[model samples]
Target: MPTPDLLTGELTLTGRITTASNATFLGTIGELVVVYKPRAGESPLWDFPSGTLAHREAAAYKVSEVFGWNIVPHTWLRDGPLGEGMVQAWQEEDPSQNPVDLVPAEAVPGSDWKQVLRGQGEDGQMVALVHEDSAALRRMAVFDVVVNNADRKGNHILAMTEGHRHGVDHGLTFHHEHKLRTVLWGWIGDALNADELEGIDRVREGLQGQLGQQLADLLSAEEVEALALRCDRLRSDGQFPAPSGQAPAVPWPLF
Candidate 1:
């Protein structure tokens, strides 16, 4: 089958994703499946301006494209059945593979996974939050830092069948302030490798060209500047930063 044109196709709603905080819908454009979140359906957030969540989602995808890491799926803003919204190609993840997971505290894998923290489970058993230790996930962590992602829950990391990891639900990104809450703290304090530094350099360079102009349409001037500053800071430090804010380092409900 030919690939559907996401930009100009007619989006038809199939169903709602009720678990999402915003009014998200499962949709289709011809034979292509996608997820849609309308600007009108966005819930009010105190820190973020109302009705801009969809724009932020698109901005995240733009940055991901600059990195060439494929951290986020193809995302863009378009008019859907509900109205103007953010539409992204739906990714079918491997059910058996979990890049991020909660396992028994003692049973955490030593070599393959990096343990984030240990906490009590709902049943009062001790559990540890862990994620795969791999180059793909490390790139995602760097991407999250540069975007100032406020929420990077375990569920947001999709483990694809071919071992590629994709991140989703990036509405809480690119704030001017330092609101980088995430579960990918496994590489904290580790020096960024050459490839990671190259990716950051690409973003830094893009900010002075087309990427900066693209973000200007989706985010405020201050937010875009902050993104540039983040890229510069990460390149300067050459290491994964530790959480450094009064707010919680990780999001509530880690999963």
Candidate 2:
């Protein structure tokens, strides 16, 4: 399906994603599967303004596009069965691979994975939260930081069959305040490579032009300003940031 069709085609809701904090649906535009989150269905959040999560989701996609890394799936705002909402193309993740995972602490891969932390599992076994040390996931970590994503849980990172990684469920992002909670804290102080720095530079440049204009429409003026500041700070620091603030650095129920 073409972009126009996905934007204007009739949305048919197939089912509800009961696990989502806000009302989320699995739906279709003709033959193309998509995920929808209606504005009216958004639950009131203490920190975020009401009825704006959908807009934040779309804003995240715009920032992702500016980064020139396909960190987020294609997302946009459109009128749907319930009401106006955010819709994103559905991704069929590769089941054979686990990009972010919780494994027995002693069993964490010594080579390919970066362990974030160690904790006790429900079954009383010691487990470790870990994610891949690949370039794809690292890009996603940077993307999450740029967006100030407050809920980059394990399930939100999708591993594709061809090694691509897509981060989803971005409604909890772009807050004016520092709220960078995520499971991708493996590279806390690692220096960002040239390509990563280049991506940050692109975002900084975009904020001076079209990307800034687009975000102004989706986020509050303060939020947009904060987004630009984050890009600048990241570029200036030249390394992955250590988690800061009074709130938890990582989201609960990690998966």
For each candidate in turn, the TM-score is 0.97, 0.97
Whole-model Cα lDDT of every candidate shown, in order: 0.94, 0.93
Q: Stretches of candidate 1 above 4 Å error?
A: 1-4
Whole-structure CA lDDT of model 2: 0.93
lDDT of 2 by residue, 27-97 (tens): 99999899999999999989999999999999999999989998888899999988999999999999999
| Residues 1-255, model 1: lDDT tens digits | 123467778899999999899999999998889999999999999999999999999999999999999999999998887789999999999999989999999899989899999999999999999999999999999999999999999999999999999999999999999999999999999999999999999999999999999999999999999999999999999999999979999998887
Candidate 1 local distance difference test against the native: 0.94
